[model samples]
Structures are given as C-alpha cells and as structure tokens.
Target: MKTNRHSLMAKGIMVLLSLLILIFIITFAWFTPPEERNDAHGVSMKTKAGSDFEYAIGFKTSQTFGEYLVTDFTNSEDSEWDIEDLHVPGKMKDDQITPVSYNLLYDYQPIDITGDGYTLIRPAMDYGNWKINTGSFDYSIAEANTQYISFDLILRSKAATTLSLGPNSYAIGASEVEGTTAKPDGSKLTGADVERKSDYGNFSRDAIVGAVRVAFLGFDDTLTAESYSTGTQDDKLNHTPSLLWVPRPDLYLNNNGNDLSTSGWSLNTGVTSGTTFNLQSQAMNDAAYSTYRHQYYNVFEMTNPNDTVEVATDNSDYVHVSAKDTEGNEYHLNDSVELISLDKPMTVQENNEDVTYYYGKVRVRIWVEGTDSESRRALSKGKFKFSFDLTTNG
Candidate 1:
C-alpha cells in the first residue's frame, strides 16, 4: 500500500508538470513568438533590393518608421516573418534618429535668481511657476499620475542560461533652442499646469535616465528560476502588451526635445550653497538640498541614498510598477529580472544564414523614473538613444 501511495504521488507530480508545460506553450502561441528582425537599406523589404532602413518602428504610415519588419504591432496584422533566421547575432540601428521628438514641458530658468544649485521634480501635475515661500511643499500644484516609458519584445536565447539585462551604450540629451512660438514669454506651469496627467499616452522620454525596470512576464519573481516559468498563466495575461519599442533618435540642447518637466519645481527644491535657513523644514517638505541634507522627489530608491549616490524615487510610494499580483494587487518587483525559459533549443535559416537560439517571450520597460532624484534635474527636451545587452550563465 505504501508503494502504491508513492506511485500515486509521482503520477500526480508528473501530471502537474505536464499541465504547466502545456500552458506555457499555449501562452507563447497566444502571443506571437520572436522572429527575425530585418533591414532593407531603405529599399522595400518586399522588393528584396537589399536597401534596409537603418531602423524602423510603429505604424507603416509613420514617417519615422523603417519598413524593417512587416509586422504591424498596433493593428494585430499578420507579420511578414519568413521561416528563416537572418544568421546575424544582433545589430543596432547605425544612423542617428532623424528629427528627434520635441515638446514644451519646461522652459527652465536658473534657480540662482532665488539662490540654489539644484532642480525640483514635482508630482505628476501641472503648477504654474508658483514661487512659494521657503520650505512649503503644499503649494498650488495639482496632484496627478506620472508618465513612464515601456515596451515588450521576445528574447530568443541561444542557450538554457540565466539572464540579466542592462542599458548599454544609451544616452539622452536636450536641445539648445528653447521656447515655443505659442508660449514664448514662455509658458510654464506648476501643479496647476500639469500635475500627473492621467493620460498615460501623453509623455516624453525626457525623464530620469537611470530609473529603468524590466519585467519578464514568462517567470515569477517570488519563485526560483526553475519554478517561476511554470508558475502561472495569469501573470502573463494580467498586464497589457506594449508595442515593440523603436526610438526616434535625434539631437537636442543637452538634447532639446518635447517632454514635460513638472512646474513650480523650484518651490520645493532646496539645493542652496549655504547653511542659513531651516534645514529640518526643507527636509520635511522633501525639497531638502544643502550640505546637511539631500533629498529629491525623483530619487526613486532603486538604490540606497547616502553621500555619493542619489537613486531615482528610492521610495516605493513614488515608484509605479503596473503589474498586479494574483489577488490583483500591484506587484512591486521593481527591478530587472533574470529570464529563464526552457532548454529546448531550435535552429532556423534565413537568407541562407542558419542560426540556433532558444525562445523566451520577454517584456521590457524603460522610463525616466519620475520619482528618481535626478529626474527633475534631467534635461527636459532631449533624445534617448538606447540598447539592451542580454547575457547569460548556463
């Protein structure tokens, strides 16, 4: 009877494993699998003239888009993916992005007029330059939601290795030419101007550069690399899929671009060159900047804040991770994660270049963590040129 019971338990575990694998396969099938990324030097890919645009993204109608891959993400159209691998390891866009994006988010004035060497990052709101009294954070700025950048893509691994991602060779700067024809005296607002606009769609990459987060939907954060991939289908389905990220690169002041920098930022900001006024009070209001204290709204605690480092929005109260838990609560694993799928290896041939790789559907997100310390101080109008490096230890 004991042997029979043991046999029963073994069978149960096997069935469970089988179910998990089935679900994993279905999940990938539900979402398109990773395929070849191609280029045509400006020649139509359909024509095969070998003229692939350096890089392309978004709708086919988009001027900035290159007809690299014929898959239309937003429209859910059939991808023109062939049953071949381009035999290339991986390559990035070679040319600079033409005409980088621009915006009227900020017309920054030097804080030295009031006395200071730092900038303030306000809440996701619009407040007209409300020059408030020293140490007052509760001024006229309206409260609102913050803007962040995000995208999703499939990572085809070549081996069953542990994976980690990092921003490689990425830099963003603002433009020199400031002020728009419309708001020339130059229009700027505080909490009253643009407090966290609820519309997530309207935002600029002119955000804190370092506060980036990655989510591998195929795995669970709480579980080990082995179990997480088999954990649940809910984690994959709960969050919305983002369009493949394709940046429109360009030049700017530091880089001038159209991203909003919260208004009345100077109000709470307290980066002064002295020890005169209330240090404790400024700290309370959260604009504390002096020899004695340093705290900024944008510093989301992705890292510990001490003498030398100022991690963006280090506090979770400010950082926002959109994924939710099984109980539907916001899941806050707010950092990039290791992506481990199956060891099942496959090979493909494209343009007669055969390649071997594993499949891992990955969701990648990047944004200026508004809660980061450097966010407010970051250039408002700029271009962010980004690339990702996926490495592994099998």
Candidate 2:
C-alpha cells in the first residue's frame, strides 16, 4: 500500500510540472510578433517660380528646375546635411519634377512731369511664364536622402521683346530731335523753338540732364530748385537702391550643354550669409529692426543684402508631417519643413559676359523637433498665403 501511494504522489508532481511548462508556451504564443517596419516612403513633388517681375521689358523670362537625391544626414543633436556626395547611388529611381511654369508679376511707377512740377505717375503690372527643360541627373555614393544630385538648366529670355516705352510714346530723354518752341519762362529760343520745344535739346543742357537724372535716380520731378530740400538729394531719401538681378555667363562656365551645373545649395545652419533657409521668428522681443522682429517672413539669408534675391510667393509655406499613435491614436507633430520656390534671378555682373540663366534650389534648413513617422503621414500637407517683396541694403 505504501508503494502504491508513492507512485500516485510522483504522478501528481509530474502533472504539475507539465502544466507549468504548457502555461509558459501558451503565454509566449499569445504575445504579438515584433512589428516588421519597412523603411519605405512615398514622396511627391511640385515646383513653382516666384518673382516680382514676370518678364523683362518685352522679353519673356525663363528658368529650369530639377531635384537631386539627398542621403547624408548628420545624426547630431541638431540635424545637419553633408553635401560631399550630391547624388544617391543605391536608389534605382530618382525624384523627377515636371517642367514648371514661371509666372512673373511686377509693380513699377512710370513718371511723366510737366514744367509746372506736376507729376503724372502710372503703375504697371506684368505676367509671364518660364519654360523648363529637363537635364541629366548624375548619382553619387552618399547615404540616401543625404546625398544631393543637382539638376540645372539655362533660362533664356524668350519674350517677344516688347518695348518698355511703347512705340506710341518716346522715352523722356531718348526722343528724336523735334522742333524747339516755348521755354519754361515762355521765351522763344533760337534752335527751332517756333514749332516745338519738346525736342531733346530744346531745353537748357542742365534741364535735359536733370530730366534724365530724375527718370533713373527716382527723384521727385514735382520739386523745383526752391521747393527741393537742401540736403544732398540722397541724404533726404537715403533708400538703398533696389536691383533686378541679371545673370552673366562669364561668372559661370557655360559648357556645350549651354547649362551650368553647381553642387547647388543645401540648408545652412545659423545666420551665416548666403544660406537659402526661410526666416522664422521665435516671437522673441528685441529692439533693432523691430518691424520684422515678431512677424514671420521669408528671408534668403544671403551674403549680399544689396544684391537682389528674388523669390516666388504664389505658393509658399511650411509643410507639416504628422501621424496617429496606434494605442491612443493621438496625432502629433512629426516634422516642419520649408521650401522656397522662386524663379532664380540671373546673376548680372559688370565686366562679365551677360548670359541669361534661371536656376534655383529648395533647401530645408529648419526641422522642428518631435517629428515621427505617424505624425508625418497625418499632416501630409499644410499651406500658407505667400507674397514676394523687395529688400535692399545700403
């Protein structure tokens, strides 16, 4: 009887052990397998050209645009992009951009003044579209999305060459010599003043020179010598002269392709000059240049503030990426990116061969923190109204 009792006890102990092992196996099976994340993303692209003047005189302005692969990202506290290798080698396909139309818009004041100091000013607006042609895209062995491959093209002036001063009217100082007539003092001068005094040389040499000066120097024609301020004409209205950037061929090499290829530009950190990152205000308080302090505005952060830096404003804004968490599915901000899409102004230089070119790159310099995969998908698109303006430094 004692032997029988021992066998039953042994069986009970073995059964308990088996039950515990089975329980462990069942628990492991119930847990979900680690998520299989594939680092794949679908990217879409669009392009636009921005400028105050869509065309020059009667000449239609044009620019070419394309995207390169970026792959090298500095995994530091602050993200940095290394542009040593501009193209991505492993990616079979590259991002392609369709030919974008560059629409030009401008506001200008054309002045006509009478001898009596009465000025008539007419403000005009213009529009034009740029023609884009795709070029060769080379690849580099840099990390994906970190390597940059630049695509560039030439921008030709294709407008019908319309006259700024139409045929109906002659330029203020360029008119042909008409007959001279009455003078400002109502006195008849000797050189054919009997018929028309509007001749190019009809007025005193000073007056003719003054008219030309006024036209180009932006002087107020209505002010007479007595009415004008005493300070050097520049002192009273000391505004830095604005410019229209015209590209020169000499500054850059023009190959047989008639195109210029550059490593292009990536986002440069800090306020280092010549960086293309857009400007943002932390809404902090400061004293100097306060008009632009708190407000958010577009800035080119270029080396030369005197040189004209043009931007396209028809469609520009921050693109926010967001997604929802699986648990609470709480949507959160993933990334903040800004791209400045504008018609690249041709760089015009003196003592250089003038070649018209249109080329620009969109750089992302600022990335707001807290960005993740899910949030990026949620806020796939965001847009703000944009406008292009002119700035000059003396």
Q: Highest lDDT among the candidates is held by which one?
A: 1
Give the 10-residue window scoring lowest on summed lDDT in candidate 1.
Answer: 15-24
- Residue 36 of model 1 has an lDDT of 24
Q: What would the TM-scores of all predictions be?
A: 0.31, 0.14
Q: Write the per-residue lDDT of candidate 1 for residues 89-137, one digit (tens) a residue.
A: 1222446434233111111111101000112233322223222222223
The per-candidate count of clashes, in order, stands at: 77, 42
Using TM-score as the measure, the top candidate is 1
Q: Mind giving the per-residue lDDT tens digits that candidate 2 earns over 1-394?
A: 0001100000001000010000000001112211221111111111122211121111011211222222321112222111221223243333543322221111111111111001111111111101100111111121111111111111112121111111111111111122321112112211333322222223211112111100101223233322121111221211211111100000110111211221221111111112221222111112221110011111222233221211112111221112222343222221222111223334434278664433212111111011000011111111101001111111
For every candidate in turn, the CA RMSD to the true structure comes to 21.4, 36.6
